[model samples]
Target: MEFSGNPALYRRIAIAVTLYINGGAFIIFALIKYLLHGDTWVLGWKPVLVTLLFSLWFGRAMYRWMMRLDAQYGRGSGWVLESVRVKLPELRPRQPR
Candidate 1:
């Protein structure tokens, strides 16, 4: 829908989301490996290359999702962060048993 809009912004957001997800997953995976082997390991280029290729698809998916959200909420990518603020419910004290 926003084919004529700011394509750079969408690409940036999608890449950022992709990196965040992949980075977090890599950290968790490394931790798991360390726990199992009791040692840390250096980063590998093969994995990096693999992730880079995978992220292309993931980033496109993220872009599509964001576009869908933007259309559904009638807001651009910039507005989604502030416009969809969720108010927390007040936590009251529980009654005594």
Candidate 2:
């Protein structure tokens, strides 16, 4: 889950997993249809295209949502691209005399 620390990696994995599950399920439907009958429109290029498009839209929304989450719980009250540039430093504990 720490891999999600990197926004790019997190987004990529999220999108990949989403599309993979949807795509795999669609493929299974197509295969089952083919096995049961001969051919069907349930599985084809259109489904894949539509899924990809939906995945893109989902990714965009997720990105925005994650940004907002980071803003709310991470730094300040709002989300800004500039936030990425500023790194928060960890404070070290002083020795107790």
Candidate 3:
């Protein structure tokens, strides 16, 4: 399948995948912590805060890295963009008010 060559669509897919990865990791970590220590706050709020920060950082980093790779190598199969194309609404730049 031919892609529309839309960077916006690529970006959206990258972001969505990154979020799912980070979210799943966070949930697993929370579950493990709760099971082992009987509470998610076993280490207090600092660890939770750190986990949240790390997840966000990791997700953003992954998205940027993937986007860079796609830009450099081009989409080989175009499967990723094709699968996500219909899910994402058309994006347009907003005019200044």
Per-prediction TM-score: 0.49, 0.52, 0.49
Residue 91 accuracy (lDDT) in model 3: 97
Comparing 2 with 3 on lDDT, the higher-scoring candidate is: 2
Q: Model 3: residues >4 Å from true position, as ranges?
A: 1-4, 42-44, 72-97
lDDT of each: 0.72, 0.68, 0.67
Clashes of 2: 0
What does each candidate score in C-alpha RMSD? 10.3, 10.9, 15.7
What digit string (tens of lDDT, one per residue) describes model 1 on residues 5-40? 565787798889899998778777767877877655
**For model 1, the run of ten residues with the poorest summed lDDT:** 72-81
Q: Which ten residues in a row have the lowest lDDT in candidate 3?
A: 76-85
For model 3, residues 28-66, the per-residue Cα lDDT tens digits are 877788887788474477876876787778766765666
Q: Which residues of candidate 2, in runs, are more than 4 Å off?
A: 1-5, 72-76, 79-97
Q: How displaced is residue 4 in candidate 2, in Å?
A: 6.0
Model 2 lDDT at residue 24: 77
Rank candidates by TM-score, best first.
2, 3, 1
